[model samples]
Target: MTDQIVPDSEHRGLVARLPQVPRDLAQLARFDRPIGWWLLFWPCAFGLWLAGAGWQIGLLLWLLLGAVAMRGAGCVYNDIVDADLDRQVARTAVRPVASGRISQTLAWAWLGALCAVGLIVLFQLRWQAQVVALASLALVAAYPFMKRITWWPQAWLGLVFSWGAPVGWIALRGDNWEVLAALYAGCVLWVIGYDTIYALQDREDDALVGIRSSALRLGGRVRGGVTVFYLGALALWGLAFWLLRADWVALLALVPAALHLGWQVASLDPADPANPLERFRANRWAGALVAAACYVVGNA
Candidate 1:
């Protein structure tokens, strides 16, 4: 079998060097794709920083590890549930579960291992945060089914993926629930925007296979849809910053992220195969810019 993944997948050279078993494992957990973890980690960072816990290096590192492990676990679970659907999608047909490189039994074991790491990270947080984190399990478990049932699974993903925003804030301090609510709301809109970009890569396959996605829902209006979502994210973030510190300088901290989002919207091309994935992957930097804004507003 060819060792290559889809054209848009990154870390190809690194993945190519790994042995077969490790490679299969890597594919199962999507370890070769760092963007998922980065997206997941950003919400945690935003929450921590926005709660004035940015200086907690140890906590931050723990959250990063948790993001990696939990994101992997989520991917494993999604692959398991979507194996048949994945076999129908060209890009996902080569996935470990879909390709039969990894059995469902082994995949379940791997998911458990990853969740064990997440549990360790959970132990590090306050009980309030722990409870908040655990509350997301049902949502995560149900996510794969959303694409089967709804035209807006990306909306569900936004809720599940942005969960760390609340966890990070509650872990440090439970006050200012308003700010945390705004931050989580902004992160959800941000996820919806980017995931819509990602769903563009699969619009044709998804439509043919009866899989619903935001890309299919928006169709030619995808760029406009993303623009609205991004604009909503910025607005909510601005509101959060205002609530935190009602100063012009605090709100200005969002400028870099605003510019980056604008670039993404302006340059988006749904018809171009590579355009969507490239724009989707660029959210890692978008996440960083948001994290920076959080730190500046919450601490500076």
Candidate 2:
């Protein structure tokens, strides 16, 4: 109900499932962070709608289900890999695994269960969408390690998170590769932009812990870097719409989301951590606006 981020006091309910559930294991899935699932689900829906798959309500529901299960699964996988690092980060210190609430073995079991649900949803997709969905496994598997290897792991996350756009497009159209690619690329940049903002919250903690992230790498240039990513998102998304519909009005659909991102960049304050997190969370709205634009343009 409240839009607060994952660590909120009320969010404890997410891990409150049972005397049955090991408290540590419950936390590992980040059941408290439903926003993660919502963020993941929306893109898939946007892709389905943009591809004119709105007629298939059943497919949309299944895709939504897939997003929830898979996002949870992804988080589990991520926690398993980052248990030690997460303990080092201020924000992640309370996480089930990092806090010793859950064991690695139990975490793996939870992951398998989440993936089973994901597989059920996967079977509902067309073969192309299924393959597309499955292809992301490697990307997802590798993501937790990316932060260890590169400052730009957010870019990698964008690819993993945005894979839904292409699969959604192909699920209906079988393959509008160019349009899908543009959307996917735009989403990658968008993730980079937003995640950089999120990374700001952990910049000090991350650095102290010996972790690497764009938030630390960008340093004073955080604003400029995010601006580039946001602007690039606008351009690519505009192109995606143009190629799909070839109309000026269709291009106009991106205006609102563009303006939103503009406001975010314009008001950004590098000295203040709150500003970035606010901007990062507001991206849910940005994604919605783009989805609407895509739908109007694609259906027009």
Best by TM-score: 1
lDDT of 2 at 252: 82
**Number of colliding residue pairs in each model:** 0, 2
Q: Write the per-residue lDDT of candidate 1 for residues 1-300, one digit (tens) a residue.
A: 345454555777888788877887887788889999999999999999999855789999999999999999999999999999999989899888898888989999999999999999999999999999999999999999999899999999999999999998998998998999999999999999999999999988999999999989998999999999999999999999999898988999999999999999999988888899999999999999999999989998
Per lDDT, the best of the predicted structures is 1
- TM per candidate: 0.98, 0.92
For candidate 2, write residues 1-32 as lDDT tens digits: 22222453336554454453454555566566
Q: How close is candidate 2 to the true structure, as a TM-score?
A: 0.92
- Candidate lDDT scores, in order, read 0.92, 0.80
Worst 10 residues of 1 by lDDT: 1-10
Local lDDT at 119 for model 1: 96
The segments of candidate 1 whose C-alpha lies over 4 angstroms from its true place after superposition are 1-4
